[model samples]
Target: MTDGIESLLPPAVAIILALITRRVLVPLSIGILVGAATLASQESSGPLSVLTGTASRFIQTIDQSVRDWDHLHVLAFTLLLGAMVGVLESSGSMARMISGWTRRVSTRRGGQSLIGFTGLLIFFDDYANTLLVGGTMRTTADRYGISRAKLAYLVDSTAAPVAGLTLVSTWVATELSYLQEGLADAGIEATNMTFSVFLQSLPYRFYPLLALWFVFVIATSGRDFGPMWAEENAAAQKPRSHHKQSPAGSWADIFAAVMPVGICLIVISGVLVTTGLQEPAESEMSRWQYFGHVIGSGNSYLALVAGGGAGLIAAGTLAIALSGVSWELVIMGSAKGMLQMLPAMAVLWLAWALSSLTGEDQLNTGGYLASILNERLPVEWLPTCVFLLAAFIAFATGTSWGTMAILTPLAVALSINLQQSLLASETLLAASDMGLSGGSPSGTAASLAMSPICLATFSSVLAGAIFGDHCSPLSDTTVLSSRACDCNHVLHVRTQMPYALVVGVTCILFGTLPASWGVSPWISLLISAAVLWVIVRMLGKHPQSAST
Candidate 1:
């Protein structure tokens, strides 16, 4: 049950089940049960005891996950965020806003920009963003000769990056909580360092930032290549989306949409800083230090929940007052929105439970992996290795959050162990130039010095997960984006894959590999961006849509 085939069984089984059944919940449940059974069998008193013990452990794992405050917070945040989206949708604010925006998009460039712009604005939730932006802009994109694949690409590309990068989105609380759990498992016991760690990783997250710009470059540059170009050419002579007949929305509807989002951002930021300062400070600190402490100690979960509630109220209130939506109707819409989020929430819960099974002492997936990787994985290659591992897992499973849940702890543990092993040997001296002149700094200094590598590896997990999610045909977001755009899902995947690969390969070569070698992330990002630009410009051609 170590890091060999036995340790691989649960994830392997889960992935196989998923591939065969094409269902998320049941496969994940079976995987967790298998993992629990394995753990119980290892400690069984006798043959018959194994079954009862495994069942007991499986139930215990579920109960433990339910009782976990962090898990509860994530579930609450998802449902609340859903309700907020629901309110906006029901009140006609979102539809009205989209209609208003599409009126000015007379060209393919203009239409693509509108889609990217809308996707960026709806950073609160990727699911909501994908569906809303795709549905709204599909008609305009078609009229402007923008292919369904192109529209789907624009929608799918912007959704995850925007949500992942934004601090107050539904992705944040869950992402940070996993990081916290991972760090704890890895032996980094700093109190409430989730936000601080996230802040550190933000700039280092090269793929998401670069990917977003890639979309912008593709959109504004009027360039197409690969299957996308063929699709663009085909669609130029034909089109489909019905939004052309949709009427322009009133100003009240647009304002209702805008105000709620603005308020959500303001409230979440305000509450994060405020909540972090709730406990009395033991000593005075500089202004920057105080701010750092505040963010570091803040309850990100509550901040998101409060923001979601306030946004929901603001959207509903404005809809009732300005959009002429009845109060009862708004409430019903809210219910609908919350209900729409159930599928995603179910996936999230199963993922969290799976994380508990893998990361906890029950399965010790992280410990087992760390044990195998201690000396075998060079410290410098850790980032790239993790990036590939995460990408493979997410691609196979078609769930980024699920990938994060399963890999974050393992990545954290591996990186920390690699750091410790490197530092405890002469390898650290050769790499960091530690010697008698500076002397091998021991204790806290070594740990502090090792942080950059650790942070880079951590960022790789997220970056790689997004890459897999971006390209995976099995990904729910990909399906929803296609459906929202009224595009054939397989065609959407086909068109997007080439572009995604360009970005993914660029990230692997210039971003993850170099960062692991101690290159600054900013420089790596610049290199990756340049590489992406060359690929797009040299290979891409202007879209041949007759409508253009």
Candidate 2:
């Protein structure tokens, strides 16, 4: 009944089935059913009841997800955003906007670079970044011979890494929440102190930083290898007939697209700061800390829902007033857009359901992985080990947030234990006694000092989880990126994996491993960048060259 091999079966089944079938929904459903059966078998139930129990489990998962306010808000945001995209497409605003931009983006490299830049600007949330970038750029990318698989890659690579690294983002709040719990259990209970630790750990976050740089490298250099190279070459050989004549759109078309996005940003930011200040402050703080705390404590999900609704309305109103589209057409466009999202939304729902089953209350998949760190190890090896472990768990579970929830506390506790053991060595004690005028500091003092290994381990968990998320087909961001580009999900995964694996391997060798041994993360980062540049230049080829 305890967390064990059973916890691994469901995700394993889901991933394998998804790959073998090249489809998501049925595989995800079967995996959930397997998970439910696993849970039910633990109870003393009859065969008939067990079958019925599996159905009950499926229904309950959806019921719980829908009833939760945050989940409901996410669903609302997705639907509204989908409707907005529909309106833009139906009214011809989207096409016209892309046509205007195409003159500036005269080459494939420029188009890819623009997409990457837009992704960086929308750092408030990953979902928003993925959806907005893909929808806005898909046509231009095609005109420039950029493959759908490549477009999906550009959108996905930027979405999570940018959001995760930014100071004020939906990911920051989640990261801070888990870090607070981890620090509290590790005997650093100050609520304000977690923000400081979070900031301190930023420099050591090598994977996200390195992953981002790799995106621009591929964009600017026009160099690619692996499955992506073949995709790009194939796309380049196609007819250049995608947007032969730019639509007769004016400034109104551009405004119809840009205004809604601008409004969405304003509304999300305003609501975040407003809701963050709702409760009275209990302590005085500096302006910087106050701002950081506000962002970390804000109701981001609510902000997202409000922004989505406002954006949808703005797009629809513009389409009707300026685009000369009939109201009926606008309604139909909205309906069509929302309907398109239904399949992706269903996959998202099933993904969330599977994630829930791996929680502490069910199969305890994360718990089982967390238990592995309890074994003692040399303090220097902690970061590398934690990085590998976090990567594996996130790949298996398909959720970075869940991996953080499971590993943060356990990794922090383990780091402290290993540090304590190292400090208690007879040689270390004698050296401390001889070097200092007084005896060693108290245990509390030693434990409170954040060591290099602690910082590396903290960063490792974050970066490794993202690395896994990039490669996992079950990841919601991956699914959204593919859907937004209208790319085949299986093709997206196949093409993206080689790039992710390259960066991931490089991250471990130059980043996590070196930092664990007290090397400067800046140096490690520089080395990693240099190495990647060499790899891309030496091995990569231009799609144009390949096709020629």
Candidate 3:
């Protein structure tokens, strides 16, 4: 039975089952059972032997794909972030700071700007941005009658999207490393492409930056959409209530919460600088040396742990000093806060593991896709096709990082192939110009067919992936945003989609036309933004219409 079902089961079936069940152990078990039963049916081997062999293969595959040190570092950083957030929240320091600011601003328009600016200031880390901004600003937004959905949209829109675009951000280093490796594999010079070149290309990352700006513009201008409009309207229809009394917390309380985050940022920056300086003068360092020097030195993880630790200590001290809270109360609050984040951490780990499994060479879904597209797609359509493909994958994966990790190499490879084909065409075109000395007219036409079809496909892929992640409900930042604003999950999704779709369509058009027409991607993006502003103005007129 297992053999028959395994033989019949498609990869799509496997993906759907895995996603729907949301049970990592069950999905992995099913995958292994299917593989084993199929092998046993094909051969005369015993069931146990087949099962053992299949299990061994799976383990070996995982071992080959998993970067243990990278995983550990991610885990450490996540825990530290969660703990730090808990400490800050428990101290009520963030609340005090936010209250102080709210008292000074005291207007709805000012509140929106403050929230957006706060998101920008925490650009170094998306998780920090989401939690800090969300937790700190919820009361302020409520006071000003802003819908929780809108607040979540603002926070979510700014977090990962902004961080991904920033040159010195955590995402950049990871993305750059991946890009550099892919370039190296293609025998391209790494030094030829600096981080600055990537930054220049980032304006072309249409989805994220556009989404961020659009959200801010809409918020500040009092435009609303979908559930956001409904929520705000409903709030307006109800009798206005007095603002909640500000909680009692002194300036010292605010400092306690902020000091930890400040220390963490300072330490991480210093470590990054030192790491940059310590890098060998050579163009490329060995993978082992790179890993050993970075992880073995323990600077990055240490900075995070130390930051969280310091924050916890400071919070406790402040609680005792100012509020007369007992040590037990502080310790209990810290522990509870850490525990509260355990489920989210588990989800993070599962997502990471799934990404690892899918990205394996033997099981690479993106590579399979590249092969299919290579055969079926016209050379001219490659850029647009890759953009849409990456968008779909990122939406399904709920991670821009995972989407890029799988797609970037494949995009690079496709670009290189297209370039080679174009080079050959140019040679034939030159031959044809020389009175068909080397080839017939028909042959020249055939050679020139693919020349006009340039490969600006990678830019499209980047843009699309960011676009999808920007709106995806399953995305980490999206979840954080909703949590931050205390908004209903479905409401946040519904409200943000209109804005996201508009930006996405703009990006697609820019990618397809101007990008294919030999214009620089940066220039194309500027034009797209101009187009977006027109659309926003038109759609923003009836804020009430968005409620429907």
- Report the number of the highest-lDDT candidate: 1
Query: In candidate 2, what residue range of length 10 has the lowest lDDT sum?
Result: 440-449
Against the hidden true structure, what lDDT does model 1 obtain? Answer: 0.78
- Per-residue lDDT tens digits for candidate 2, residues 1-548, read 44787877776677677546656677777887888889877773799888888888878976674575555666677677778767777888755665455567678889888888777866756776787778778787778889999999999999999988985455665565556545544455555455556766887888889989999999989988999999999888887546664554589888886787678778878887897787455498888877876764566667777887888899889988888989999899889878876765666566566666755556766446545544455667888887887777677767676566556655664565456445545445676678953344345512443567878888888888898889988888899999999999999999998898889999989988888888898999999999999999998999864222
Off by over 4 Å in 3: 1-50, 63-67, 122-139, 142-145, 163-204, 224-239, 244-254, 280-372, 378-491, 511-521, 542-548
Residue pairs in clash, model 3: 226-546
Worst lDDT 10-window in candidate 3 = 445-454
Question: Ten-residue segment with the worst summed lDDT in candidate 1?
Answer: 441-450
* Model 2, residue 243: C-alpha shift (Å): 8.3
Model 2 compared with the native: what TM-score? 0.64
| Candidate 1 lDDT by residue in tens digits, 295-338 | 87787777777888888889889989999999898889889878
Residue 428, candidate 1: C-alpha displacement in angstroms: 11
Candidate 1: segments with Cα more than 4 A from true spot = 1-22, 189-191, 237-248, 278-289, 360-363, 426-450, 544-548
Q: Between candidates 1 and 2, name the one with more favorable TM-score.
A: 1
TM for every model, in the order presented, reads 0.89, 0.64, 0.67
